[model samples]
Target: MRKRERLELIKKLILEHKISTQQELLDILENAGQTLTQATISRDMNEIGIIKIPGPDGSYIYGLSKDKLRQEGHRIDETPSILAVSPLVDGLEKMIHVDVVPGTSRLIKRQLLTKYKEMIFSLIADDDSLLLVAKTDFYQQVIRQKLESMVVSDEQ
Candidate 1:
């Protein structure tokens, strides 16, 4: 398998099971017939922006940074980060809600505006989330889909 294929497998493995260490990941890859070294796995993890987050059992599991929702003692969900994609209107009629990694909200907002400047009215950035205000429901859906697509592509 190519490096991208292996990385995708690694992401799948992380999502499927609570993988906390490089050795565990290597063993899983070995079982799947992809022989890779610990160093390679480490490099891949870095390249893919994987981080260890606290699981339900208080053990750390590898996942994308954006996968974490910072609430006190909250356990990380098994669902892939991309799976958290949802666009819901807030109490305000034109406001839409979405979350991203802590530091990248501004960049994502900029990208969203750049891509859908006509549809998106404004973006309100929070600590680790974004509230997108679009011109209409149709425009909101378009914005949501675009944001979700960006996140899903990042996972690859």
Candidate 2:
């Protein structure tokens, strides 16, 4: 499998299983019929910022680092909310909370501004929440409209 696909599979397994060692990871991949070398695994681990955490079995298991410090200068403790939105000409910032899956936050953060360029400056995303800081009220308004439109009604 390609590196990108392999990495995604590794992440899926780690989230779904109790993996504590490279051997276990290797077994998982092998069972899935994709072989990987230890060196490749180690490199993938470092690239993805995987870390070990204490588990109930008195052993440390591999998992993604959820620490804010590991995040790219975005403080997770910062309770982000849509503070305000002003027109671009008026000079204001907009903020909003986006509820998304934890694993997809990084992917969303990478291209938010480019994908939605109307009024976003930056984004701070965690497991299930994203703080979008808009560069102008126009952007804020646009984002709010998009979000509201995306809201799904509970129905059969």
Predicted candidate 2 versus true structure: per-residue lDDT over 109-139, tens digit per residue: 5546667965678778774467888887777
Q: Best-fitting candidate, measured by lDDT?
A: 1
* Model 2 poorest 10 in a row by lDDT: 78-87
Whole-model lDDT per candidate: 0.68, 0.65
Q: Residues 76-137, candidate 1: write the lDDT tens digits.
A: 54333322355464666667677665444554565567778899788887536777788987
Q: How do the predictions measure up, each by TM-score? A: 0.44, 0.44
Q: Give candidate 1's root-mean-square deviation (CA, Å).
A: 11.7
Which portions of model 1 miss their true places by more than 4 Å? 67-156
Residue pairs clashing in model 2 are: 82-95, 86-137, 102-127
